[model samples]
Target: MVDVTYNSDLHFEHTLWTSELTFWGGELKSLENRLNELISHWTDKEVLTKLEHYLDEFNLQSNIVRDIQKSIQQHEINILDHTPNGSESMDIPRVKEHLKLRHKMEAQREIYGNLKKDFFLFSSENL
Candidate 1:
């Protein structure tokens, strides 16, 4: 079904462990089948609520991934813009914009990295 719980605090290690357990020892296919069955039986009101919740969670996750991806893409663009691939070198204005965007992207990546590292380490220890 939909993972509608709003938590950016999802532990990676916990997820990995749960996934492994599910496939190995837990109800893997049965869970999917059960969900399908529920969907099949769901009323219009219930289905709409489920969809709404899932959509909200999906959008939240989407925004996060999009922002990170955009930052990385911008970093690459900045690097390319700064480098002289053609005959002419980058001028002062272009160089300034490139450096600014590159720095912002680097900072954002660092934040994402640190959060992931902390989440993994914490979950590993707790698990």
Candidate 2:
């Protein structure tokens, strides 16, 4: 017999949190540049329209990330805010906001997939 368990002692540091924020900012910029390149290089109006839609969705994701970062910084919220030893009471605003962004990102990932497929089709059509 084997026993498997989960540990609730896992915690992240402030540096990790800040690093994540920085990563997201860079990621958004990269995505924006990619979309702009696609729009400028592709002559297909339909494909350009699709890319625009994806860019709009990407902007929404960027806004959500920025909002979360701002909220955390403004409130001085740390990664352990929702941890067992971190907060004495049921303070879970950070956790809730993170979960919300995660859900949005999950949906955004689907849009990204569609964008990739469209770009592939555009490439093949041009060739």
The regions of model 1 sitting more than 4 angstroms off are: 1-87
TM-score of each: 0.36, 0.52
- Looking at model 1, residue 108 earns an lDDT score of 44
- lDDT tens per residue, model 1, 24-123: 2233234334445555665777554653444444344335545544544564455455555552344555445544644654574465456445534643
On lDDT, the candidate that comes out on top is 2
Q: 1-127, model 2: which lDDT tens digit per residue?
A: 7432112211233244556667766876787888898889889788788778868876876776676556545434444444466443334565455555545545645665675576568557753
Candidate 1 matches the true fold with a TM-score of 0.36
